[model samples]
Target: MTDKLLNHRAEGSTTAPPLLLGPSLGTSTVLWDTVAPELSATHRVVRWDLPGHGGSAADLIGPGATVGDLAVLVLALADALGIERFAYAGVSLGGAVGLHLAVHHPERVSALAAICSSAHFGGSQPWEKRAALVRREGLAGLAESANSRWFTPGFTVPELVADHRDADPGAYAACCDALAAFDLRDRLPDITVPTLLVAGREDPATPPAHLREIADAVPGSALVEIPGASHLAPAQCPQAVLIALRAHFSGGAKHGMEVRRQVLGDVHVDRAQARQTPFTARFQDFISRYAWGEIWTDPTLTRRERSMITLTALVAHGHYDELAMHVRAARRNGLTPEEIGAVLLQTAVYCGVPAANSAFATAQRVLAEEAEGTGG
Candidate 1:
C-alpha cells in the first residue's frame, strides 16, 4: 500500500521533470515549504519526510541503519510514484542520502545537489556520542539546542525545532547511527552525475570546508557558499538556495527564464507560465531553453537588433498574433514607434504587401494598447 512508502508531498504538473527533495535528519518535508512551490513551476517536485521525523513510521529504520538504507527507502518511494529516474537535492542528512543515490544508484539519478552535507561527516565519534545521549535522555534536551546547532543567531524555524522535539527517539537515534558510519570520501570521485555542493558559511556542524571537500573530490562538481546561513540554509536563505537549485538543475532553462522575463516582460511571462499545462510543459521548457537561453542570449546581436529581426520574421511568416507581441517587445527593446514602422515598411518589400498590411494592423493595435497602458 502507499502507506508503506515514505511520507511525501508531490507538486507541479505530472509531465514535468521529476525532482526528489530530501530533508535533514530531524526535519520534516516542511523544511522545503518555502522553496518547493516555486520550483514546482518547472519540476514535478516531491519532498519526503525522513523516518521517525514527520509522517513516516518510526520502525522504518533501526539502530544499525546506514545512509544507504535511507537511500533504498527513497528509491522505494520513487518506485511507488512510478518514477524511474529523477533529479535530487537534499540538506544535511538528506544531502547525504542524495549523494548515496548518485554514487550507489547512478542510473536512477539524473542530477544531484548536496547542500550542507559532507563526504565523511568529520568521522563517527561525535555522532556516536550524540546518538548515545539521545538514546539515554530522549529528544527534549537535544531539541532545546537544535536552533543553535541548526541556524545562525537570531534566526530559527519553530516548526523544525518542534519536529526535533516530536521525532521518535529510537528513529532519531538510528539516523544518528546512519550519520555516524557515513563516509563517502573515497566514493566522491566515483560520482559522475552533475553535482552541486552548497555550504552555509556560518554552519558549525557541516561548514563550508566539508562541502568543499566533496567538491574537490567529485569530478567536475561545483560549489557555492552562502554567508549569513547555517546548516539549514534553505530555511534561512530560501531565495539563495532556490537560485542555486535552479541553476544546477536546469542551467539553460534558468538563464532562459530570466531572459524570457526581460524580453517578454513579467506580466506576459507570468501569463504564459500560468497557462502552462502538463501537455505544454515540454514546449514551455523548449521556448525558455532554445528560444531565450540560446538564441536571444547570443551576444552576436543586441536586444534591439533581435527585436527588429523577430518582427521581420513574424511579418514574413504572417504570424499576426506573434507580430503583435513582438511589436510590444520592440518598444521594450528601445525601438521607437517610427523605427518599428520603418522596419514594417522594409518587411513589405521582401515579405509582400498583404503580409505587411496585416502585420501593420496587428502592430497598430499593440502600439495603441501600449499607449493606453492597457496591454503589452
Candidate 2:
C-alpha cells in the first residue's frame, strides 16, 4: 500500500453510519460534492482521492498496484479512521474496489453499493490502450476517451472535458490498469452484505446490462437505474442518486419510495427546516417527484419491513424530528404497536437505549395522535 494519499472528509451528524466512499478514475472527492449533502444528512460520508488522483501521491508501482491494492488501501484508511466496519459505496473504479472488499473482507462492510461498475469490466482493450497512451504521451492522449466514457451526449461540458484532459497522465494510466484487471464475475455470489447495483440509463461505459449482471450475481442485491444520468450518477442527477442510495442504505426502500418519503419527508423541506429557512413553494416538487415518484413506486418489500428499517435508521442516527414523523407514517401505513415496539427494541441494541427510547416515546405520541385523528 502506498504510504501517502489525500483523504477528504465532510462532517455530517456523528450519529449516522460511517460510509467509506471511493472515487472514479481521474476524479477526486469533488465527484461527491453534489450528492454529499443529501447523503451526509444521514450518513458520515467519507471520500478519498485514490492514489494518483487529486492531492494523493502519483506513484504507479508494479503488479500489486491494482484495484485490489486500492481496496486494501481503503481498508487501511478505515482502520486509520477508527472505523472497524462500515457501509461501502463506490463508482466505476471505486465500485470495483468495493467488490473486492465485499468478497475478501465481508465483515468489514455492513452493506455495499456498486454504481456504474461491472464485475468483469468489459473488453480491457479500451482501458489498456488508454493506459499505454498515458504512459507514452501523457494525460493529453486519453482526454477524448475519458470524456466520452465519463459524460453523456447532451451533458458533456467542454470545461470539464478540458479538466479531465489536463489531469495527470501517470495517475490516469494507473487507474486504467486497475480497471483493466478488475474481475469479480464468479465472486459476486459470495458477497453476503446487502448490495445495491446502480446504473445510469445512458451510461455507455458500463451500460445497464452490466449493472443487471451485478445485481443478478450478487445475492439479495437490488438494481436501480438512474434515468437520464450517465456513469456519473451522483454528479448528473444528485437528487435521484441520493434518494436511491439513502433509501437503500437506510433500508427504507423496501416499501417503495412512499415509505421513504414518509420517513425523510421532502429533501427540500428537510433542508430548509434544518437550516431554519422558510420552505419555498418549489419544495413541493422535491417531495412529489423524488421522495415519492421514484422510490415509492417500487413495490418489492412490505411497508412494515420498510418502517422497521427507516425507524431503525432514524433512531440510530438520532434524527428526532423525522423519527417522529415516520412514527406517524408507520401508523398510517398500518404498522401495529407491537411492530413499532420491535423496531425500537432492535434499535436499542444497534443504536442505543437512549435513542431507541426517544424513538419509542415519539412513536407512542404519534400513534396516539393518529388514532385520535382517525377516530374523528
Candidate with best TM-score: 1
Predictions in order: lDDT:
0.92, 0.75
Cα displacement (Å) at residue 159, model 2: 6.9
lDDT tens per residue, model 2, 259-344:
44454445633564456434543354355444555445547866667777778888888898888877766765778888889889
State the lDDT at 331 in candidate 1: 89
Clashes of each: 0, 3
Clashing pairs in 2: 257-295, 257-296, 258-296
| Top candidate when judged by lDDT against the true structure | 1
In TM-score terms, candidate 1 sits at 0.74
Question: Model 1 off-target regions past 4 Å?
Answer: 1-3, 254-358, 361-376
Q: What lDDT, from 0 to 1, does candidate 1 have?
A: 0.92
lDDT of 2: 0.75
